[model samples]
Target: MRLDEYVDDIEQDDSVALRKLAEEKSYAVTEYIDDARTRFDETLTDDTLVGSTAPSVFVGRSSYPNVSAGVLAPVGDENDAEAYATTGEWYQQGFSIDDVFERRTGLLNSTRRSNVDVYDVWDGFVGTQREVALADDPVDIELGLDDRPGFDLDGPLEDIAAPRGPRAFAESARVTENPSVPRAIEKTLSDDDWRAEGAITYLYRRGFDVYDINNVLSVGALGEAENRRLVPTRWSITAVDDTVGQYLRGTIRNAPPIDRTLVWHTSYMGNDYWVVAAPGDWEFELLELKAPGSIWNPDPDGQLYMAADNEGYDGRSGYVEETSGAYYAARLGVLEALADRDRQAKVFVVRYATEAYWAPVGVWQIRESVRDAFDGEPAVAETFHDAVRQLVPQLPVSMAALRRKSTMAAGVQADLSAFGAGGDSSRSR
Candidate 1:
């Protein structure tokens, strides 16, 4: 029977698929680490790292007002420093989870304790770090560390950043060459009266990706000169995503809505994404189901962990608490896709994390997954409720569970008794 016509109770078993993917990922990670170690030089037993290409800068929020401002540079392949920089292009290049880990693990974060205010301070370690962030390409740098850098891979993973590698306290940092600054960025930097939000929107409209904007914003490069202050990299990432997402949302506010309900699906880094776009005014919801053994839900015997957050046509007033950064990342992706089509949608995006998603490789994948979800032809449905019913059995959670967490799902409970009287259904695929 067609999924929308008949309701049934079914549980998906992805154990075999998970096992195969796990084995492949394990092999790839091991091989990548081995290759990296071969190219990585350990001779920096001294406190100085020389001739490294500074690809990015990180501002840590560990101490609040007093932060850890640092530069991120590749240790060995100094010539290819730009590859270590995080960008959405990594997704376009088809970077696997292991590839992301390997790239991030190759760069060392050299930091120095400093106040969050660095808008006018330019001549020291912080200045050098800002220069790297402002540069269009990797800048050659020399870093004098307080001690030998520590390489530890056993720390807890981050949802907003890739697996970072070595770390050290930088006593001094020097830029060896002139970093090329793009004109758009230069213009933003020169505008003393421009607010950060306005500058962010301007940059997005001027063809700057969120990744670059995040980097620049983290170093206190944007905003009115007096109000500019360093922002932590983690905060900057989500901030840029949200800022740009709001811009895209405004761009599509007056556009026509989609004519039909469309469903698209894609998988990346062991997570499966299902995006449903229905004809309506602007609305977005993200529903996440993490398998028991997934990174976020690590207890093998625990129940599935589900989280959801949503916004109406007017947009969210406060931050999304349950889904956090993933909400903004995924929302930005859907909005970008909608903006390109010159249309708006009531977007419901579901992410199912299988046990194979063992590592937390940050929220970039979430953004990329939804952005590319529309690449192929989508399943068409007559109604949004029909689309939800069609995908219910394939989800890890039951229809009831989804309805509990999803406002949109709850609104369509008129046929409750019909859906409640369910029968067993075979796997159609």
Candidate 2:
């Protein structure tokens, strides 16, 4: 019998497939570091510091008018600083959460509390801002700090596992040497009236990735005068995703549909994803399965939890509360792939979070994983429902539950009924 026929047995009793999932989630440590716990040893002292390229910026989320904003650079050789936060390097090397934390924990953040609307050049902070915003390459910087910085490891969902280094309130910062800036970025920054959204879209079209754009925005480097402010790091992440996704959606609004039902599957960092692209309009849905004992569902005796949210052809005006940032990030990846093919489709993405995904790596994993999933050879089916059925075995959740939570699946089922009732239409929305 097919796997679905034994759903009851699989749910109540241990199965081979489930055992395999458990094994995959297990981590293999080659060696243990005794100093791993000593890394957090912070001394409450201040002194002049020099570091390399500006890898990132952090905007603290607290207090309405006054918030802490900082530039992040690793305390290491100038050349290695660029590699510290490079997402491509991290993904290419197959670095785990601990590997990332090991590097990130060494970064020294020079911060200052300023009004959210403080975009004008200041005596001390402006120099740091200019270097971070416009530098084509990492530059040497000297910083004077008030005291030994505190470690910040606090964040939501995915960011909760991110390692943060020591942060000190900045007394002053000065560049040791002038750094080269990209002509395009320099021009955009020169225009004080340019809107942040426009600047982001322009740079993205010019091949600048979201990582670079978020840093710039967080440093208050974009947007028109009177509208510019330091955006919190968490907020900037979603902003960039939303901005890029919107741009892609505009391009595919009138595009043609794909030729057939396509199913693509990929997994990384313990999260498994199956995406179905069916010939239709630009509608999208995300169904998430958090298995019991998974990071998100830590209780071994707890039942599995499934959540989903979707948008229609026109897209949503409000936030996607259920899936949060992953919704926009994954949606952008799908839309970009569809736009590249010059075809639009009703996209359904199903994500399975197993115990293997014990650590949070942020939403970039979702965005990139879904994007890479499209690179593989797809399994084709004649209809949307057929495609879902073909891929259902990969998920631990029951089909009945998935259908209830997946708007796209229900639409496909309804269209099937309409076809049987003598109506010839197969597309929904």
Candidate 3:
């Protein structure tokens, strides 16, 4: 019987035993919902990346030659063979790793909605800036100290140093001289070690399944001299409570006993979405929700929730929250494409996924506005933006944020100078 109905009966007879059971169930259900709210967001790069750790790159070691100014010299093939493969210009993934559509075919396309999405092929790797002569120096022109007439042998080096002509490692942050290259590299270098993990690989790792790391992640990359490498973005979202963990433990149908506190989340949004190696013929993609707080809960808000296998997409046009029409349109954008493509051609890019979509720290206000607006509607499965317009309406489109109010005019967005809930939304937004 429903808890409400059972409670009514207990009330009519004042039965203590019945009351106890209803109360117990009520707590369980609420806790369940909270845990269920917890979800893993890999598309975070699409909407994450804060601080100076931006995705933008400065020109060579010196600001003199802006890297953005198209200075990559033609990458010569090994041995400079005229008929050999030529390295292409460096570029970002067509889409942010965090993106996906609600309906993902094991082999087709995917989308990332309101949730943070991204992938971590390797962890603890750092974003690098090399100390180079040009890659490191400032862009200012240095007129060679107008020929100081004479050379002095009796003077200190400081008196003879002419502002150190064009610093070899000026614009760069980390530089290693040729003599400094570690005499003995503790590790062997290989493109195979840079393998990218897909949904299948993720599951395999989770299941204690072992495989060759290189075979699964990256294949052979361009020659060692190319100096072309990628610095994967690491993402994390936090929540407000322990309820999220509880919910995660019980939410997924057949999950292992969850013990990780969900303080942050790991994204799956990246160069590719799913893994190809897992043997199981189960359902769609491999998106497991993680809680930096507890592997159980997936809600960034901390209200215990479990969103395993759930996919969220930002619902907005470039910046405006996707109006009902746009929301549905975003969904339809994928669904219509999928429907038209029969069984095999289900995969196609609706919007060419770009690194700009993933790296947001340096975006213009307009760009940020769109990203923020779309975050309001985190559901991607509800395609046809028109169909899901109701998901977000007058729901604090501005930064006032969402809070339960006694009346529409109540201070849902007011400062917590006087409070019912705590200050940080992570605790009770």
Candidate 4:
């Protein structure tokens, strides 16, 4: 069967879709695992390089006022490891989740317990921070580990097969050379009064990508006052995505809306996404459909699991409790495309997770997939409901079920009711 025919099968039932998709394309989840395990085994006796192209700083969640600050870099040739750090390259190269894990598993995590707010110039943290935050290119470093670290296959279902990197307490670390620093980063680092948020926005506007900004923030390189502390790596990822997303949103606030409803779809690592942009205010919603046998919903006989979250024109001030990091990541991608067209629209994103998306490759896939989806020819419709009707046959759930979970869809229903009551509507088609 063709791809389109397979997609048509998805709307009927999960088992049918899975069976058809499997028959259409041979998916070797075990092959991916074997490749990652082979690469991970090779790293056991090899010396690794951290921060080759870009350094990764990790802040531990424990110890409260004092947390563990660590730097991570892959174990490989200096040039190769450096290239591995660039996520854009990975995306462009079409690297799979297993490929990403093989590289990440080779990283050496060297850590030390320190006060979160400590940024004294004479301390070791300062040296590591400067090297990671200011370096314009990859910086090679040597680490003295207290002991050899072990690997584990334990993680969330989305990332279960990916081997966790080995970690050890750092006895000492020394940079091989003075890293080439960007003047913009140098200036930002010099200014202690600049808040992290402002620095992130400035760097992003200045053409520095999120990966660079994330390194800076993770190492406690930004923020005002003497209270600047290392942000946990997980937290920093979401923070940078959110910060940049907000910046893009601000630019499109007054921009003209798109001429019509546009729907774009793409899939990566077994997660399928549909991005729908309609003519209206800047409302947004994300609806996720997890197949019964998928990782999040592991019951073979269970119904599909659906979850959604949304926000109005102003966006949400608090965290997106439903989607977590994925919300910000996907939102950033959508906002970026809208900003590029100099247009604003109410966006409704629908995601379908099949059993094939068995392993998590982080939210970067979502961000990039959504970004790329907009590049395709979109399916256009005259109304929001019409667009949903058009898309329903391609999705697993019914329109009524989607409407019940999606605030934006609910809003559409309310709009229809209001129009019926008053006979005319102010919302533009």
After superposing candidate 1, which stretches have Cα over 4 Å from the reference?
1-18, 21-47, 154-162, 414-429
Candidate 1's residue-wise lDDT over 225-337, tens digit each? 99898999889999999999998999999999999988887778778898989999999999898987778887778778888999999999999989999999999999989
Over all chains combined, what TM-score does candidate 4 have? Answer: 0.83
The digit string of per-residue lDDT tens for model 2 on 1-429 reads 322332222231223444454454323111111132243232222354444466556788898568887777765434677776646557657666556556666677788887787677645675476576567677677777776556544333344444456677888877777778787787777788998888989988998888788777776778898777778878888899889888888899999899888877777766778888889899999888786766777776677677788988888899987988889888988988998898999999988887666656678788888988888777677788776765655566545555666777665453323323311112110
Q: Give the per-residue Cα lDDT of candidate 3 at 36.
A: 22
Cα lDDT, model 1, residue 230: 92
Predicted structure with the largest TM-score when compared to the true one: 1
C-alpha-based local distance difference test score of model 1 = 0.82
What are the RMSDs of all candidates, in order?
Answer: 4.3, 6.9, 23.8, 6.7
lDDT of 4 by residue, 83-150 (tens): 55636667777766556655666566677887767555435744674586568866777776656654
lDDT for position 373 in model 1 = 81
Candidate closest to the true structure, highest lDDT: 1
In angstroms, how far off is 193's CA in candidate 2? Answer: 3.0
Clashes of 1: 0
After the best TM-score superposition of candidate 4, give how far the Cα of residue 269 lies from its true spot, in angstroms: 0.8
Tell me the whole-model lDDT of each prediction, alpha carbons only. Answer: 0.82, 0.70, 0.19, 0.70
Each candidate's clash count: 0, 3, 105, 8
Residue 117 in candidate 3, Cα distance off native in Å: 28
